[model samples]
Target: MSETHDHSNEHDHATHTHDGKPIQEDPLPSLEAQILEASVRELLIEKGVISADDVRRAIDQVESRTPALGAKIVARAWDDSEFKALLMSDSDEALMAFGVDMRPTELCVVENTDEVHNMVVCTLCSCYPRPVLGVPPAWYKRRDYRSRAVREPRAVLQEFGTQIPDQKQVRVHDSNADLRYLVLPQRPAGTEGWDQEKLARLVTRDSMIGVSDALAASDIGG
Candidate 1:
């Protein structure tokens, strides 16, 4: 996932712990890159450029929230077929049911199919349904993913250990400025008796990304 870090003060970097690992290496940048970056930073600092705290606060705001809007949309789709149909026909109104209101009703949502699964990727920048899914994943923003996914989505999905059956269809959604997309993964079998809460637990983030399908009761934990 994309992460925002605090850089309010130079010393702030010293306060973090990564998996209980000691902060031995800074792993920031090469000497050349560092000098260049520092010069630009110093210039900005000298010019009374935006404070490090402001930058840190913005990053915090981006990372602190969950994709509740996206989750709500998905959950409601799972619960109501009529709404799901509406989501297909009119995504804006459908999103409103779950408290997601996108201004342009032109937005589209593609449901993952048994033969054709759908995934969202932005080849340029991290264009996303922020009102719903929040920020995109770090990997999603990587050049490799952005460049190759549109060209070879199946290959990238395979790299992520997601296999698309040979006979199944794959639809790659290229998210640009005007269009926004979301994946509605196929609900799993053996969930006939499952309720919405139980079903939500089965909705893995990967499933929403169309890399995997929702889990059945067997996949749930206590």
Candidate 2:
């Protein structure tokens, strides 16, 4: 196994282990739990802090797909050398190329490297590039991933079917602040003169999350 990150003292799974036998945990919460949850919602509604429409809108926003927009930006970066340079320097401009702008928050930075890989994890909470990746999956929100990734990124990547070489460096990003991150993975081999549409297929959600690299031709039968 290769070392995938820097140990310069920068900033910064598994299963339900029960008794000897396999003990199935409670699948559903008790009736009391549901009632309590409902009561909380009722109280919040009564206080007028949030309305049904607001809740529905929030749900709709998460369910909406904005992946294509980000895909277009990434595809452009794959092909255009000048744009890639601009992206490394100014991500907001790079993102604007795909019409995805991070206006209020300019702290977001896109880091790129050849040997070491980058991945973003908000272990404390579900911090994400909602405008680009839309909403995050449930697992990314868990405290386990957020706490462990910054410590043992290699192990986390393995679970995602991504294993870094012992020689390579792995940089696990802890998105503990308002600054968000997007990975600019290395272009996979055997993809010479490939078009944007073809290249977009290689960029999986895992690649964006930093757990896995972009797909190479061999992996996708190219």
lDDT of 2 by residue, 1-222 (tens): 103333235322112222222212222324555677789888888999888788889889767855555556677788988887887788887776566767665525444466778888875556787777777776776556766777778888888888788878787786767677777677788998999888888877667778777778887779
Which clashing pairs does model 1 show? 115-169, 116-169
lDDT score for candidate 2 against the true structure: 0.69
- Candidate 1's displacement at residue 126, Å, is 1.3
lDDT of 1 by residue, 29-135 (tens): 33555677778877876788777777689878767655555655676687889988998998877666666666662557788766788877765556777666667
Q: What is the lDDT of every predicted structure here? A: 0.68, 0.69
| CA error at residue 125 for candidate 1, angstroms | 1.2
Worst 10-residue lDDT window for candidate 1 reads 14-23
Q: Judged by lDDT against the true structure, how good is candidate 1?
A: 0.68
* lDDT of residue 6 for candidate 1: 39
Off by over 4 Å in 2: 1-55, 107-112
Model 2 error, position 32 (Å) = 13
Give the TM-score (vs. native) of candidate 2: 0.73
